[model samples]
Target chain A: AQRVTQVQPTGSSQWGEEVTLDCSYETSEYFYRIFWYRQLFSGEMVFLIYQPSFDTQNQRSGRYSVVFQKSFKSISLVISASQPEDSGTYFCALSELGTNTGKLTFGDGTVLTVKP
Target chain B: NAGVIQTPRHKVTGKGQEATLWCEPISGHSAVFWYRQTIVQGLEFLTYFRNQAPIDDSGMPKERFSAQMPNQSHSTLKIQSTQPQDSAVYLCASSLDITGSQNTLYFGAGTRLSVL
Candidate 1:
């Protein structure tokens, strides 16, 4: 079985503040991938980040970056310079490739609110 | 890209009713995914497909949940004997199939289901 965990259920920060969302996963396969998505109040699910394995290059999109740790089975998303528009739910995910199927398993999201 | 498209932005049903959610992946995408989201449970993976084939459905509830992708372009998730606990936002996502390790998912706005 594969599992992903996001410990923080809610987080809030003022404008220009920085925040971090935590994630952890358990899988038997050594190779893994991580994903981060944002869901707003309107119920739109948006793609934010995708990281493949411990050796895969870290992905950066403006203010978002994730650190991948293979030994501890953990990953974290760091959001810098938060804005009101960034208020939403953030999700962490894990996936592994196989001969049979490919599926991404997700964690309970962290709800983030950025105050203006 | 139009990204992933899910129909019936919202639906309301009574207990024991049947509900079907649809998803159309990006034009050339070969992988599709389904998920359920609620305030209490957050995001939960339901099932996914690769190249129009049922991949892993370990996340789906055995009693009432079923998913299918008969063609490469679209997939459907059907829930029979729906319960109040089934009320949540259903999200559909798609990705390329080069390798499960290189998967980058594009998501839809999601179908918000409310049970009365």
Candidate 2:
């Protein structure tokens, strides 16, 4: 069994400031991938970024980046220069490699509110 | 592309009634996945299919839930005897393939299901 945890239920940040959402996972599999997604108020889910278990490099995309701590089995999504439009629920997900199953176990998510 | 398309953006069902959700994956995407989202559980993987074949359904409820993909383009998730607890946002996603570390999923604007 695998589980993902996001302790922060809500987060708030000022415009242009950086906001970090924490995530941790427990999995016995040696290979897996972690993903970040944002759900808009319209109910659409937008992909943000991902980090593979084997790659030690942290992934960054535009205003979004990931701090992957493999030793502690934890990861965090950092949103730089946050804007009001960045307000939404951000989810962290995990996918096991070689499972041939496209199933993703997701965290409870952190609702982010960015003040303009 | 239009990305993954889920039908009936909103639905209201009476107790014991049946609810069926539809999904149309992006063209050329070989993998499709279904997930249920709620405030308490976050995103729960319901099932997945690859190349029109049922690949994994371990996350689906054994009795009242079922899913099928008759072709490569579309899939369906059916919930029998819908209950109030079943109310949630059901999401559909698709990816080109489910291999290695590059399998990124594109999601649809989820269907919001409400049981009365």
Each prediction's interface RMSD? Answer: 2.3, 1.0
Question: How close to the true structure is residue A83 of candidate 1, measured as C-alpha lDDT?
Answer: 93
Clashing pairs in 1: none
Say which docking band candidate 2 falls in.
Answer: high
Stretches > 4 Å off in candidate 1: A98-100, B98-101
Docking class of 1: medium
Superposition-based RMSD of candidate 1 using all C-alpha atoms, in angstroms: 2.1
Query: What DockQ would you assign to candidate 1?
Result: 0.59
Fnat values, candidates in order: 0.62, 0.82
Best by lDDT: 2
Error of 2 at B46 (Å): 0.7
The deviation in Å at residue A104 for candidate 2 is: 0.9
* Model 2 alpha-carbon drift over 4 Å, by segment: none
Query: Model 2's DockQ?
Result: 0.81
Please write out the lDDT profile of model 2 over residues B75-103, one tens digit for every residue: 99999999999999999999988997547
